[model samples]
Target chain A: AQSVTQPDIHITVSEGASLELRCNYSYGATPYLFWYVQSPGQGLQLLLKYFSGDTLVQGIKGFEAEFKRSQSSFNLRKPSVHWSDAAEYFCAVVFNQAGTALIFGKGTTLSVSS
Target chain B: DARVTQTPRHKVTEMGQEVTMRCQPILGHNTVFWYRQTMMQGLELLAYFRNRAPLDDSGMPKDRFSAEMPDATLATLKIQPSEPRDSAVYFCASGPGRTNGETQYFGPGTRLLVL
Candidate 1:
């Protein structure tokens, strides 16, 4: 079975500041990782995904995540966050087997302040 | 841009009532998925379909929950005698293919509240 852990439950950052949200996963083989964001009362939107290739993957709204196999982590990061970037972010991992489902973390709520 | 669409953006019903949520996937996507989101559970995949065939539904409660894709564009999740515990935001997602790794586009979701 695969599982995901997000260490931070809530984080607050000032506008234009750098931000990083930690995510760790437990899976047997190379895992397919993803980061998603959700606003209040809205469905989740995919921020980024990592299947293979480059360790650092860029995503929409100035978001990016790095896949660190050694650390079993796919932490989401942004160099400078805007006020509109505040939302709940979830990290998920998919098992490589057929007919597999994605296992998600508890999610981290980001609060951006000016 | 193509996107997934879900019906009944909000549903409020008493316990023991039948609740049905509908989803229309992207025109060319081959895989559709149903997920439930709650404060405690986050986002959990309740069921998945590929090529209009049920692939996995282990996350779904077998007794009261059922999911089906009668055709390529349509997917439905029905709950008979829905309980208060079943109240959550249900999301429908669609992906391009059945590969292990694919980015899924999600619908706005149906918020179900069972009183």
Candidate 2:
């Protein structure tokens, strides 16, 4: 079975500051990775995902993640975070095979200060 | 801009009462998934369906939980004799591909509270 672990439970950043959220996964082989964000009273929104190809994948809202097979990690990053970026973030892993369900991390709450 | 839709954004009921939640997946999407979110658990997959057929439901409690997709667009999850421990935010998501890399669009979760 696959599982995900997010070391940070919460992170606080000032506006315009860079941010990085760490995520690690345990899977037999290379797995699909994704980052999602959920604002208050809203559904989760996909930040980005990694299947194959370039190690660094860019996503919506200026978010990006690097897939490090050696580290078993897919860490989300943003050079400059906006106040609206405050939300709960989740990291998930899915099997390479089709139609597999995702195993999600516990989630990290992001608090942005102006 | 098609998106998944869920009914009864908020549901409150007494213990032992029956509660049902509904979902409408995006058009042309073949997969639908149900997830539960709480402060303690974060998010947990409860069930999923493909082609209007249940594909996995191992996360759901057999005794009190049931999930069904009666048609292409409609999916429902029901809990009988609810308990306070069951209180959480229930989310419905759908996607176009069966592959692992497919993006799933989520609907605003339904908040269920059992008193």
Candidate 3:
């Protein structure tokens, strides 16, 4: 079974500082990776996704992720952190060969300090 | 805005009661998914459908849980004799289906509490 690992349970960053959330997945084949953000009492919002090619994908709210096949990682990064970006972020993988269901990580909570 | 919508944003039920949660997928979306989120289980896929037909529901507890799409726009996840362990936020998502890199748009979850 394919699973996602988000090493950081919670991360605190000063406003305007750079932020990075690490994610690693265990999959035997080429992995389909994604990042999503959820605010309190809100639905999960797509941040970005990586299927193939380019290796780098840009997403909404100035977020981006790099897919490293060798490292088995797709880490979400933002050059500057905004207070609004403080939310729970999830990393997910699609293992469609087995089933079309998505497997998600435990999630990393981001806190921005002013 | 062509987004998924879930009804009864909040539901409180007693144990052993029947609970039904509903979802309206984005128009034109061919794939719909049901997911449950809790503090212990971050997010789990319970079931999914394509073109109003169930494709996979392996994540669901078959004995107590049932999922169905009565029509193209509606999907339902029902729990019979609900338990406290079932307390969680149930989410519905929709996608284009059968393609790589397809994004799933999630609805505001229905928060359920089984007391």
Candidate 4:
């Protein structure tokens, strides 16, 4: 079945450490990729999205993601992680077409240590 | 900024009880979606509507789950005789349209607990 997969279920990083959350998808068509962050008891907020544009996309909160067509991956990165960045991160792909309902992966939880 | 809103932030109920959750999509949005989040299943799309019309609901249980867009502002999900397995956070999302960079805006989910 075509699906989105987040390789790491949980990741721990020291404050100020760099962060990378991997997202891989199995799809045949050109995909629109997205990254979203959700804090505890809060709704999901869009981090960044990759449409038909420059492969590297920047989003709010100093987050960025790269869309690598060769790997079918859209990995999220942050140069310096902060304590507030500890949250559940989900990678999504528009199931069909450019903009439509998204298929989300099992999220990766980020734990920040002091 | 405008945001999607959901009603009854939290609810605790017994098994076999009826449960209803409501959502108010952002104004001028033409698409609405309902999703359920569980540890076992992750986030699953339950149903969606386009311009008050049901587009797809294959993810929802036909026997017990029902979703409707009563108006432009209101969308509802009702489960009759809900079970403990139905306990999860239900989220509502909306977009300006189906295509053309219309990304979804999610609401703070309604947390439902069925004993």
Candidate 5:
């Protein structure tokens, strides 16, 4: 079975500091990887996604994720953390045959400290 | 901006009651998906419809949970005899055909609490 793992349950970072959230997956092929962020009391928003070719993909809100086939990882990073960046981040992969749905990880709660 | 819309932002009902949630996808989107988010389960895809046709519903409990798209603009998820365990934030997402590496725009979500 395919599964996504986000090692950190919660992470705290100071404002203006660089941040990185780790994600690892178990799949036979190079799956369609995505990173979504959910603010408190809100729906998920796409931060970035990686399908092929590009190892580093940039997304909205100055977020970026790098896809590493060797490690089966797609990690999200931000150059500088903002208070608004405090949210739950989820890493997901496409597993279904039709490839319309997603299998999401348990997510990592990021806390920005001033 | 065109976005998916879900009705009844919050619903609190007693156990054994029937609960219905509605979603309206973006005008031209061809695929609609239902997902449940819980603290324990994270997020799970309950079902999805393509071109208003049912595709895979394996993630949903067939007995109590049912999903439907009565027409192009509306999609619904209903739970008969709702239970406390069914309490969670349900989200509806839609995209163009096949996803095509396209992003699935999610609605605000309907928060359900079964007492």
Candidate 6:
């Protein structure tokens, strides 16, 4: 079974500070990893995804995630935090088996402060 | 831009009532998925269809929940005899193909409150 784990339940960061959200996964093969963000009472927006090629993938809103194959981790990072970046972040893995959906983590709630 | 759309942005119903949530996938997407989100469960895939065929539904509760795709553009999820436990947000997503690694576009979701 493929599953994702987001270690932080909640994180607070000051504006302009660097941010890193940790995510680890368990999968049988080279997994398709994704990072998604959801605002309060809104649907999820894809931040970035890692399918193949380079380990570091860039996404919308200046977000990026690095896929570490050996460690089974795909952590999201931002150079500078903004108040608008406050949202819930989720880590998901797409299992390659048939009839499978993206398995998501419990999510990490980020609070940005000025 | 093409995006997934869901209907009944919000729904309030009593226990034992039936609730239906609808979704319209992107025009050319070939796969549709239904998911449930709650504080405890996070996001869970309830069911999914590939090319209008039921491919998987193992995550859904068989007794009260059902999902179907009547056409390429439409997918529906129905809950009969709704319970308070079923009070959560339902999301619909679609992807370009049935491949496992396909990127999915999600709908805004329908919030359901069962009293």
Residue A73, model 1: lDDT of 94
Least accurate stretch of 10 residues (summed lDDT) in model 1 chain A? Answer: A94-103
TM-score of chain A of each: 0.95, 0.95, 0.96, 0.96, 0.96, 0.95
Residue A109 alpha-carbon offset, candidate 1, angstroms: 0.4
lDDT of 4 by residue, A1-114 (tens): 679999999999999999999999998876788899999999899999998879999999999999998999999999999999999999998867744778999999999999
lDDT of 1 by residue, B1-115 (tens): 8889999999999999999999999999999999999887888999998898888898999999999998998999999989999999999999989576787889999999999
Q: Per-prediction TM-score, please? A: 0.97, 0.97, 0.97, 0.97, 0.97, 0.97
For candidate 3, write residues A56-100 as lDDT tens digits.
Answer: 999999999999989999999999999999999999988775455
Error of 2 at A53 (Å): 0.5
The alpha-carbon interface RMSD of model 3 comes to 1.9
In candidate 1, how many Å is residue B13 off?
0.3
Backbone clash total, candidate 4 = 0
Indicate the docking level reached by candidate 1. Answer: medium
Candidate 6, residues A1-114, lDDT tens digits: the string is: 667899999999999999999999987688889999999989999999998999999999999999999999999999999999999999988877554479999999999998
Q: In model 5, where do residues sit more than 4 Å from their true spots?
A: A96-98, B98-101
Off by over 4 Å in 2: none
Q: Looking at candidate 2, what is the lDDT of residue A49? A: 91
Q: Which interface RMSD does candidate 4 score?
A: 1.7
Q: Give a tens-digit lDDT track for model 4, residues B1-115.
A: 9999999999999999999999999999999999999999999999999999998899999999999999999999999999999999999999988475468999999999999
lDDT of 6 by residue, B1-115 (tens): 9889999999999999999999999999989999999998989999998999988899999999999999999999999989999999999999988566788899999999999
What is the C-alpha lDDT profile of model 5 across B50-93, one tens digit per residue? 99998889999999999999999999999998999999999999
What TM-score does each model's chain B reach against the true chain B? 0.97, 0.96, 0.96, 0.97, 0.97, 0.97
Candidate 3 per-residue lDDT, tens place, B17-71, comes to 9999999999898899999999998899999988889988989999999999999
How many residue-pair clashes does candidate 2 contain?
0
List runs of model 4 lying over 4 Å from the truth.
B98-101
